[model samples]
Target chain A: MAVVVMGDVVQLLQRQPGEEGPISDALLLAALANGDGNALAELYLRHHLKVYRFLARMAPLDQSHLDDMVQNTFLAVRQGAHRFKGNASVQSWLLAVAANILKQHIRKESRRRAIAAALTEIPLETTTDETPEARLARQNSMRLLGKRLHGMSHKLKTVFIMCDLEGISGSEVAAVLNLRQGTVWRRLHDARKQLRVALAEYMEVDT
Target chain B: MTRCPGKEQLTRAISNDSSAELDAHLMECPVCRDECEKTRKLIEMAKGLPDGHPTSQTVTRIADELRATRPERDLWASARPGYGVVLVAFLLVGAAVFAWNYVFYPPSGPSGSANTNAERRDSPKGNVTASRSAIYTHSIEHKGYAFDEVVSLREGTVTIQVTPLKSNERFMVKTDDATVEVRGTVFTVVATNGRLVKVSVKSGKVHVRPKHADVAILTAGGQWRRRTHPIQKPTAVLPHSPDSGVFPIASPEAASHLTKKTDRLDRTDKTVPAPMKKKETVFQEGWSLLRKKRYAEAANVFDNAVSSSNGKDLNEEIYFWRAAAHYKSNQSEKTGEALTDFMRRYPQSPRMDEARMMYGWHLFNTGRYETAKQEFESVRQSPLPHVRQNAGLGLRRIEARQ
Candidate 1:
């Protein structure tokens, strides 16, 4: 066999005959569980962006922290691959693990007693379509919302973020959080009420 | 408006859990209707939050870490030399260990009362505790390593008191249930009846993972539990003191010095006068050769030392090194004979306990489980914690094998 390095293989990127389209996330994870390095690379390429965005929203983390969390979530997937029972979608499972990792990190840093406000400096301009004034309004609302979340308990904030903001269904939130659906709805309601009181000035005065 | 359906039910209604009473209130009361519309708008506003994504550094780091942690079996198999080479290497390590014990502490005959003091001076007297209820505390403080902490891993239902230390060090304590990691913290771990491992931190923090449970980082006043039959939810508790103490031992500093000396001796310049014919010089040359891993040359040097009349005075030490060199040269029978002779002639030797422990391991490796068990039991009462721990692990390994 000839010696081959990572760069030399890039020129041979064409798919071999009969190799089907993009593999399903679950199947790629299953192959990863079998220690297939290629499957791991493919899986990371597919889900790293979605996971990174989720982690950034999940905690008040810097760029390094966001990068580490994404890497940790995938590394965790590799370690716990055999334990992936497939009860939730692989992406949902990854997000839940990322959330738990944040919780542990917060707990270790002695900030569990109080949420570190704006733990994130979320850059607000994600779309070019919105006018500058409109983007500023959204940024202020999010910044105010982040502060309001800091005052709320972890449970209520997680339920609110997943259900009202991320748009995950209440039942799915229950599965991700190991809580009852009624409990999820109740927390979401509590979170929403707190935000209403905290952001009434912004609410009464439109952007 | 008769107090609208309680806050709980109103909250429930936001998720569309419409009770008849709430629906009637919304229909009849304009105030309640306006509140519901405002609440709905609040959720919509939150949903409009901008997306956040990370840079490509995350992907590259993940790939590199995955590659680094790949299983070592493939590399191990591919790196092997021929069968002859492996047999020779194993013999070398076994003999080297044996020679290390003998040369480091030469034997003392029955009347050598003066020699007993030398042995006593080398004995490591750090700390020892009675394993009452199968739970006890052991303090580990190594200034050389990042270890100036005391952590305990207890099996069975026993309460141990651990005192806080004033240093920056980390250490790991393990039992059947979990491994507890401590870094300059005071904590206690208890395993109840060999079925569970429980860790409670009084100050600082500790990382613990039960064999089949989640990794938990426990802060001061936090407790973690892993059980064969888990029932109670793992949670935090207020910190409390049971009992704690400190025992000062200077072994860590001495060990650091020993390591530095060994490194110096092991380096070879390969320019020495031909093997010294004088008996004393022969032993010195043999020791130097062994340090360099020149096993065959060392074996010949030690053999020459033993044959000379002066060798009689240091036969126990010479025999130990001779056995080591033979083992290193893959001469198993000669190695066994040398060890047996040393054991019989110097029963009161300072290294008798260590020899027995090594012989037990040799027996265990050669499938003589019964003899190995006996050898391990003989040294089960060794005062050294490290030796006792090794013996305990060895016993458990045998039982597991069976």
Candidate 2:
């Protein structure tokens, strides 16, 4: 843990244990809570891509408010750093925060529909050049994926994304979501069922 | 007696979270085992999905946002009432007490400072009277300010004197409609008409702002009048003003010229009973009213003068005075039009630079940004140092916004 003195901030007390050579993620977070700018810069370098990936997967074509969502998530990290329990890994905690921010964002039903519709209309920007047939197939699959993913309830969506996409174990997700492992497994099952049906329909249309 | 293992049991086994019972159930049923294999493949596809990343601009923006919110952290921590709260509360109470004492118990004499009373003191006898013509005099000290306002509240040509203790101190003799703000000065503010206050700065400068009107500064040897009531009856002069020789309403110099002409009229036309003013006389009267700050009355006179002088020279003075009257009345559109006409008609006027700055400021205030920038830019190249400095500052302000 490292301490930084700031005006009106009496003292910074380290909570997370420190390490040698390279700072652990938990130690970096503790330093950030203590107002360490260097710790924040390092954490940003490590986690910005993962946070952005989470947002883009959720709201694919909503480029307009994606920056705001990402910024708000990190802002919460700085403000709520003292409350970080470090029970789960820091990556799981960051994903949890990003998910919570996203939940609050799509709480408005109209905005959720608008973003989903927009995502369906615009093809994802592929890294390589895309042929007409490949582009259409890619766009159709992406639309079905986005629709099927968000169509699940937030509980199932969180469990599904954490377990399947991010490679977080069901136990880690259960810890992050404050749920039992059995409940996390049940939600993950429901999400997989809905997604399989959507994928079956999508594959049939393609054939 | 067991049925097929469900999709949930298949998910449990595929994600490696299987209990002994779930594994046995999945292994015993062929359909449940096949479902578990498809679920594993779906999870594998999700793990191999292409990543979507943020641009570098976005990362910097998030860091900047966190930095901006850093200031709110201290406030959030101390939002509750704590140790320093008592000291802050005590200081506020002390400030309130000091304010109360300063307003009601202002000191007497030159050490006293002025506070804006809730209601205007009608006569000096409401508090302090120094024997000569209901005089209201006080000394007040506030925030280390000391001053005296010797206000004579009697009728008929009573001169008021003020002694300002500091350079920034203000003393005023307030009337019903106008507040006469002065520093160390000697001035006479007469109730010229039932609804007008005539301020004659005998020795020093005074700033007089009428009720709901902008301030107008008058220097020594300058004379101006403002209306004391909203409903003013257009009268020539105060009835109580006995010394008509120095009366500002109709200047003695102007009267002399009119008298010399009247003498000629009497010689030429003996039957003329009423000395009716010619159109030239009417225009001169409007110009005289404008110089005296009787703008509403002057505007009417200027309008008549402009209509009559259409066939004649329509002197440059008419345009300038008309614009001045319009500006004082807060008619910005008319003022803009009039000033534009004046600048075109009299490009070589001595007051052109100051007038250009006025027009630019007017344009800026009205949100005509591009035209205002052009105006300020052209004025920034003026030979006059002060004008150039002012225009340069204006351009900088506009540029900062841009």
Candidate 3:
């Protein structure tokens, strides 16, 4: 009897760390289909924090609005559970949903803010103890960094977050954002170059 | 010897997998090295910014919401492995009930073999059995009527004080002679020897019928008599003067009318002996038993009273109480039979009106919708104002469902 190599391809896609050897995604789906609420809860618990963090970074943290986005993400997961084909990891599917929820939240907030000024004012504050010269230098550095990051294109910002902040591999970022791996690499390179030009003075002062 | 890398090539060169050729080019090229170092610092700076983790409360809130929103069946299934056992036990109990009804107490047809002797004895009478002892009597004074109580006419005569007469209220008084229908009034109908039915209206008016005779209306102070021959035209005057041994009355016509009506009837017909005072006590004991919800025992007691009375009127209250007992025990068929028998034997009874109302409801609950509708319609059209109103409501409900 010969085992097909296609089985390995399927296994490679679904492999997760800390999981017992390789439980089939089909078995997890079967448990869910049997009206297993605990299985659904366990699936949610595993990825909800990361999903929330992704949305919070993407959208302004209006406590109430963020809460609604979080709720909507899980609700979509629940309703879309049947459609899950085990092609991708559950974490990727959930992150996709969270991204959509964040996008929706941004659109809604923009419309709402257009009609009225935001009702909740976020209190901003400084959190460092420093001498006057140090404070001035820190302020200049922060301003330069913010101006550069803000000036970068949306594509570059996304690449920077995915590759640098989130520490996801360029390939995984391509998978998550549905971009080509080469495209992701190109965007990160462009963003870093733009930042270097903007922060040239800061780098000179630090040296 | 060196070449400066483009920004894209420089970014790729920082990767551990980049070839030594790319690294060698980067070390020799200051412009490329400076560009790569700045890109590295910028990347580090972006990573150093807040990671944007959710607060603990937010995580807790989301978890709670997920838990609360989870379907109830899922929680039960996950928590308990014993639900299958509980469900099976429930099904077993339901099956047992179904088995008991279909196998042990199968429904009987009109004249089926399943009919018990007691049921046979309770069947409608083919001929009116004349008995001196079994007279059922019911009387209502200022207080209205309770349909379940039997009226006893055994004390030679009983003065039934029908009071607070509401217009159109119908009362059926059954005597050996005929059934008397009263439309609101205080009246006394004395049954002597269970053969003579003499009616005297103290107030209001009463319509009297001697078994097969046309109804005759007797007004206040009016008297009517039923003898062996037939009821003579109602004489306006009293039959005996106040000087004669009877209650003294200011209206001589009324007093004489009552005396004459009582005297004309033959006393020779055997009177079903009046229930002994002790036996009456036992009848009351049975009634108390019914009130206590001891239906089976109460029915037995009522049976004893009826049988002891030689099947005569058998205190109407006894049968009424018996019906109630059967109803309490969920023996709806038996209760229906008892109520029907009560109606047949005491058609003109004061309690008949109430019994019919209750029986209508009982029939409705038992799914005898057509029969219940008929009963309700009858009461709705009844001359009694309260009965008409009650029956109208019941009819409306029945019609609404239909």
Candidate 4:
């Protein structure tokens, strides 16, 4: 990959798709620091899916809540764009900011009813061969899994979601959580063990 | 066979770490193998949950929110490192130009005359619109970037319309017997017979301080007039005594100096009905010098009266004027001493509000901001609105410095 200088980044951003190499996150963030709304829009287009999936794994947000969380995360991105030191990847920085927003929201909205409603709303993936009964069973099991995930401590749950579910690297998870890599792996192991015991009955039925 | 890997180790293996030894053990031990499989199956189920990607409309909503809340562009953000220095230098130069125009070369009356009777004279601080027959000397006294527009009226009527004075700016109208101070107001002062006879407020408020009386606040449509009394003959000069009546006596030296002005004092004596006594007419003499801005001489007269005076209320008035004189003459040490004594002795004095405000500025000019802030805060409760406003201005000055 060529080293995209500041001038090249703007030119590339201006160009239509399939013209040059993809713009780096750091360059997009630099544009964001300059108060370019286009950079934020581009960043959202490229990364909103990943951000949404990450939040869904951590918390059961309804469509409205999910939209608000993503909007707030990007808002934080816009505000703190100048503070990015390029020490970590943009994805890690984003996840760190998202984690903070998520924790704050959860603290403010402590009612279990919202989380329960979200558990039932988790979309089910089905195949043509799947029967109605099997689909219902799978949906119930998924709901139970989401409930259990929500039930875990926030620390253990975030580590599990970032590491195992989202496949974020252990080091990246550590950076996002501001912990040692060893601590991150330790929490991941603990989270999985807790989930294993809690889901032992469901596993037996699946087998 | 190796001991079966614990659940924590199995979870780790199923998550990120899959060591060769662990793999061999898992292959050899069915118990461990089944446990790891179950964990893997559970993990797969959790991972298989839908991503629930947001819709285009949701992204659009987020973009709209970002656009709505986006801060204005930061000029220096995109500039190269060296450009910041140049930008800051330019800003500094611009500030210097502004300070020079408004602070150093402040606008003055026509012909550079301090006593101009033009219908209106404009200044950055405020404007002075005087009557054609108005006999007044207008001067701007600078206190750093701030100033006071002092209009001393010897006689005749002057109608002054002043703009809102800045924290450091003051506007005042002074006569021999009265001083009208304001932050900003349109008011007219009529001085005759060596006295401010009548003051009427057209807009805003003014504090009218009549000699030997409490300060009076006059708002729009409010007017204060000195009580009309028959002009009497000057009192016969006698030895200094504490039994003097409405007529203030001066020391022998002060009496000789003030003898020529005795007729003016007698004519301007609006406060009446009491018999005259001794000849130490120091208060009236000092007050006359103060009205002429001869602050050093006035302070000297007041200083002598402060020791020789016997009446409590008379002493209070003398102490206040003495400190005020020292302050105006820029005698820092004497002002501090006089103000301290005045504040200490007359904490409950009717003139305490003005005393505190004066002390507040004296402390502020000398860099005692903490105590100055307290003094101004105390003056914030003054009954006179204009005095309270001046105190507010003083507080703002302290805040800006801090």
Candidate 5:
């Protein structure tokens, strides 16, 4: 388990106030819990863009599935509001839930694919020439990384994503993943090493 | 040949304290210099993906969906009418309805009248008839409070209107298999078929204890559903306290005074409430780690903050900090995930505008450009001028690329 050390956190906490009042979240939560329609709307207004974009990144670019997952995630939060303990940041916990939801979606998709494989004819692959060269290159890199990400061990990949991709501090990653700070550091180092090795061939192509 | 810094040391040196020793090493060693440049390039390359934005249509659709699926208010309305009277009224009304239906639309099978009568007579406080055909009636009373009640439980559902004996004082009802605890509040508990228990806390806190499980406290506007058996696992109980002995349900004034005294006592001793103290320490630690650019470590601190407290305020703060740390560390996937989570968890957070901006940036970095542009465009509509300005800048950047 990674313990986020005390001294490092204090510095971040000392930054300029992003927003004011400690009681605001509680008040908003209370309103939501009470089934205040306006409160729920207000909450949506505040977070809709962020959550929608996040889902779009994680899922397919198609709006239907992305919208459904995002909607379901919010619905779950609304239903599970009371169970929320103010332990982790509301965002991290929600992300955990979203991640879980994504995992479930992947599992369901895999199952659907398996069922389809058993019952339907296979489709042939087709290449597209519509994307620009630069765009194609960028897409290739993202696809390569995404595929490689799935092959890495859970802990290593999570640390890599949290630190290198998401910009979370090693300590914060430790807290979210419940690993020690040192372990988070070690895993991050190992993950980067693995990625470097695994993507070496791909990087050569780019160069 | 020159000394080459280990990966961890180099990473720490890049993100942590800028010491002269590390600087000196970097200045002297070509290997370290090359490694540093490579690391920088890797980070930049990873972050260079095209951004995307959620369309306005998507945003509107989500808002509409949220409005549609929000929980009904009827759940909390159960707690207000004074427990005893509500219970009695429910019993009377239910019996009338059941008798009317039973007589007018009797099932086409032999009914066990004797057993049903016996269950009706003996079922109250501490006893339940296990037979599938049995209907149980149970009641408990706290007399000095604003409300008192004798609740009748038929099957597994309970109707309650118990008043709070004191502010912040909790009135917990425990059964052999489950407990529905209430405070100065009104609520209802429906334990369907002895397998699942549903609780709606209209006001105050409702703590549910099922058999051997540690108590789960739910506040006003909160509801909980749990299985009777699995949650009874042994690892749930908190350590017993000397002050854990049952206190008489006192008047609201007395309860408030007692609560204050307890707070004072808790303060005098270093034994701060676990939830509050946990938040302070975790927040402090998480913030410090974030400032040092040790994002992984900061995230861990935020995680501890969520696990140690039930306060919504702390949870929201932790989410914001975690999002910031993820963004700073350049973990686009995790950054987006954290922002999404923050939005879902604290949709009403005042810092939502900032979260939206970052989320859009994460999407863009991950090569989801159209989605990023949409998010930025939405931000352009914000009431806050600064937010709108930033959103406009983001939108222009996205559009200009195409």
Candidate 6:
């Protein structure tokens, strides 16, 4: 599966699988475990966006921490590559690591916040195309979304994000979370019920 | 209406895990259908929020860090099943021998005893002593008094007195902030919050290298300390101070003048009463507070000094130091105000480049990218190579983020 030894990963990935061109994610991970830096870079280019998006949604309170979280996720991938047993897809494994790191970072941030109650509040990022009213509405919606997500329990949040938003299967998420499939379905139910109530309130407020 | 499908069934259907039974129920029951639709729309709203797409610089930084670090070796990946059996047998045998020796030959010497607080040797008695707050350990090899040892003090203080060592010997006391390399000297080091706060030599000389500063040789009765950021390399060494008994070193000229004045005071006034102690200047008081990391109090003192100043240079220093105190203490509003005031009052200050870079990062972090870009652009023209390089990186980061 490790065919292209010295060429660009993008070129290699673009070719058909039957033509001895594309490397599988597992093959790249095997090379990474074998200390191949090129394989690591390839895997990063392939999956960084997914990992970044997951962590961004998970830790919506601080957009700045996304970069650090992504970096740490890939670093964890390199360190834990050998332990990948193929029970779940590589994307599932990557998200699991990203989720763990996000949890740790949130815990640390909470402790810091307790010690120093006030942190400098950075202004929200603004796009030139957004009008004042639209911007306000968007900002309010996002703020409410972040608030609800942040308020949810970590388990419910992880399950909802993985199953509902990222579209990973419940079984894949169960393996990543080390929980039974039944528990995952149960948590997803609770998460949906809570979010539905929130959505009702939000729609009422909007009208 | 008939009891709707269970919560798990509804969740599965919403997540597109549709079965024939759940589909028939959702088709018939309007309540379940409405619930599913609203929940799906809520999930859609969540998916619509913008992802925190990282800049390319973050990717490059992580790649660089990964390249610099070596991956941990996985030993079992290549090991044969027979190898594990053999390894377990070997470990069992080794453990038996160790256990036999540990029980039968229960060690008796001072070198053999392990204490929770201190470590020592029989021959080199009283060489290392530490307070309860200090955590340390020591080991002596069979190199014939060529003692090569290290004491790691994570925090607190440790005092060491070692005899003159052979050319091959090496001894060091490492702290969070600095390393004190002993040349067979007697010295004390106090570290707090992961930085060396004080180092005093008693009988011989020691070379101290603060993690962020240059190496400095300090002789007996000489002392060194870190009072602020980027602790400057010492150019002039001297005894402790008379007023506070702690020397606060700055530039070479300042250290030299203070040394001479301290020497004259010691030589002429050997019998001066304690009540005749000279009062400390406002700057000195504020400086002492800063050294103690009492940043809020130090900022207040510097603010007072700024208003009462009589000279241009001193006034500039006061304003700059006040801004620094505000920055260190995380008083964001006060920090911005002080930096703005300093830049307006002293446009030609020597430290303006540093101030601009600091303010640039402050603005950048606060999402004021345009103003941050201007600050960084101005700093990029600095004569200092490091400052210019940092400013260039800052500009690149701003461009990437925008």
List the DockQ of the predictions in order.
0.19, 0.19, 0.18, 0.28, 0.16, 0.29
Chain A TM per candidate, in order of listing? 0.74, 0.79, 0.61, 0.82, 0.60, 0.76
True contacts kept of each: 0.44, 0.36, 0.34, 0.56, 0.39, 0.55
TM-score of chain A of 6: 0.76
Indicate which candidate wins on DockQ: 6
**Structure candidate 4, residue pairs in collision:** B249-B280, B249-B281, B249-B282, B250-B280, B250-B281, B250-B282
Prediction 6 global C-alpha lDDT:
0.69
lDDT (Cα, tens digit) per residue for candidate 1, span B179-272: 6765545666666544345666777777775665556777888876542211121111101101111111112122223222221111011123
On a 0 to 1 TM-score scale, where does candidate 3 land against the true structure?
0.36
lDDT per model vs. reference = 0.60, 0.63, 0.57, 0.72, 0.55, 0.69
Per residue, candidate 5 scores C-alpha lDDT tens digits across A1-207 of 222122123112222457565434434444565565555666667766555544433433345666677677766666655554444555554555565565577567664464334222212123475457755655665555544554566557656655665566666656656678788778877877776676676666765
Q: Note the clash tally of each candidate.
A: 5, 4, 22, 6, 91, 0
lDDT of 5 at A107: 68
TM-score of each prediction: 0.37, 0.41, 0.36, 0.42, 0.36, 0.44
Q: After superposition, how far is residue B121 of candidate 6 from its true place, in Å?
A: 24
* lDDT, residue B362, model 3: 74
RMSD, every candidate, angstroms: 37.7, 32.5, 28.7, 25.3, 50.6, 42.7
* TM-score of candidate 5 to 2 decimals: 0.36
Candidate 4 TM-score over all chains jointly: 0.42
Which ten contiguous residues of candidate 5 chain B have the minimum total lDDT? B233-242
Poorest stretch of ten by lDDT in candidate 3 chain A: A1-10
For candidate 3, write residues B148-264 as lDDT tens digits. 112435435555554332231235666665665654466666676664457777787666666555467777888776534222222111112112211111121222322222333
Please give, as one word, the docking class of candidate 2. incorrect
Best by TM-score: 6
Candidate 3 local Cα displacement, residue B293, angstroms: 99
Q: Is candidate 2 or candidate 4 better by TM-score?
A: 4
Worst 10 residues of 4 chain B by lDDT: B237-246
